[model samples]
Target: MIRLHHVAQTRSFRVLWMLEELGLDFDVVPHSFFDRSLRDPAYLALSPAGRVPALEIDGRTLCESGAILQYLAETRGTLTGTPEERPDWLEWLHYAETVGSHVANLTQHHIILRDPAMRSATVMRLEAKRLEKALEGIERRMAGDWLLPSGFSAADIAVSYGALIGQRFTALDRLPKVSAWLDRLNARPAFQRAAARDGAAQIYMQAFYPPPEETPHA
Candidate 1:
């Protein structure tokens, strides 16, 4: 069975969600970011950066949410696009990583964190625009329900996770297709189970954020 070292409120939720989607029973070893438990030696052995959502399979350890999604897709074969659709699937997967990372960075740094004194307003504005363009790019291609030519796959999972994280910035209102797609994805029973698992971990992380500043503001 796969063992997931999950941090409650992070991208690890996506991994748990994917596993549930696959109908695979995996073990969860919850780690808390608030206590900095992720940086502990044991967890660091599995993830060099002590990040959440580390997966233990057989004996090998896997980190990074995108890689985990790909591993699951390739391993299960069920999360795959058709033969002719492979190129498109691969493209969208890359899109998720490249475009999604930018989106998450903007949302987390600017919107979620109360770092007005620390954040760069100019940079955040630029990131927001970049994210908007990326969303528009995806919207142009998302003619059908899924992101790829074929049905739902790992590519969709990866993109959906990115979309959910970044939704705080764009909202479904600005991107109707993406919103509709997320609605469809979330409606899945498996996705709901995954969400419940991820939500449990997130509730655990609420204790971590809003760190103390180096110099107290006068």
Candidate 2:
């Protein structure tokens, strides 16, 4: 049986969406970031870092979302992209983390740090800018509806997760291409199925978390 440890609105959603795209039958083991369940020993055994997207499949477990995507694609012989496009495919897959890093920092400052004093306005603004820059990269690279010229592949699923969630922290007003790409992704039947099962928002409750307004020295 394939089991995916998932937390709604987290990177785990990448794996969840991938499974749906592959039309695989799997079970989602729901988890919560606020509940401290991730710190438990049992869950820790599945994911040493106490993070989400730990997938159990083929008698082994994989924690990293990109790795899991590659494994599923390679083993399933689909969504791997043409052999000639492997280099671009790999680049986009790993680039997802570049987008994810800023998202994590923004999420920490904007949400996890409940106390206003504990949060840094500088960091929030900086990360949001950095996240915007990352999205800009995608906007520039997007020559077509998907990341690759070949067609939709796992790379789209991997990197689009950041764009989907990153918009919460960064504005997409200038990112017309990225915004359009997201609209296309959201319309996919598989993405719709995944969203239907993605449970409810636990981490990102706000529609937008703008950076703290800048202050001027008198």
Candidate 3:
């Protein structure tokens, strides 16, 4: 049996959405970002770092989200894109993390840090702006319906995860193409199905997280 250890709104959502897109029959083992369940030794055996998106399949477990998506595409014979588009596909697949890194920082500062005194206002603004710049790169790169001219693939599944969450930190008004692209991605039946199984929101408590520096005085 294929089992996906996942946390809602986390990188694991990439695998969850991909499984739906691939029409694979898999079980979702839900996890929470706030809970210490992931740190349990038994869970560590599946994912050394105790992070989500630890997929158990073919008698072995997968840890990283990007690697898992690539493996699933290759094994299932789908979503990898054509040889001509391989470079772009790979570029975008990895670029997801570039955007993700910033979102992670923002999430940590805005949510995980908990104590207002522990978070840095400067870092929050810097990361938020950096995230916007990274998103703008997508705006420029996306000269077509998806990341590549070839068509939809696992690249979208990988890259779009960041864009979905990135919107919480950075406004999409400057990213018309990305806004439209996200809309298209959300409209997919498979994406819709994945959304249904995305579980409760354990990470992002709100739809938007503005930088502390930007918050107005009361």
Which candidate number maximizes lDDT? 2
Q: Please provide, for model 3 over 1-218, each residue's C-alpha lDDT reduced to its tens digit, 9 standing for 90 to 100.
A: 89999999899999999999999999999988777999999999999999999999999999999999999999999998898888888899999999999989999999999999999998999999999999999999994998888789999889888899999998999899999999999999999999999998888989899876566869
* Candidate 3 Cα lDDT to native: 0.93
**Candidate 2 collision pairs:** none
Please report the candidate that would top TM-score against the real structure.
2
Worst 10 residues of 3 by lDDT: 208-217
Q: Which residue ranges in model 1 land beyond 4 Å of their true spot?
A: 111-115, 200-218
Model 1 lDDT per residue over 1-218, tens place: 78999866577887888898898888999887658788789889999988878999867999988888888888887787888888888788778876777765675665456667877655666666677788777778894988766678888887777677666555456788888898999898988887777645343223222322345559
lDDT of 2 by residue, 118-217 (tens): 9999999999999999999999999598899889999999999999999999889999999999999999999999999999988888899989999999
Better of 1 and 3 by lDDT: 3
TM-score of 3: 0.96
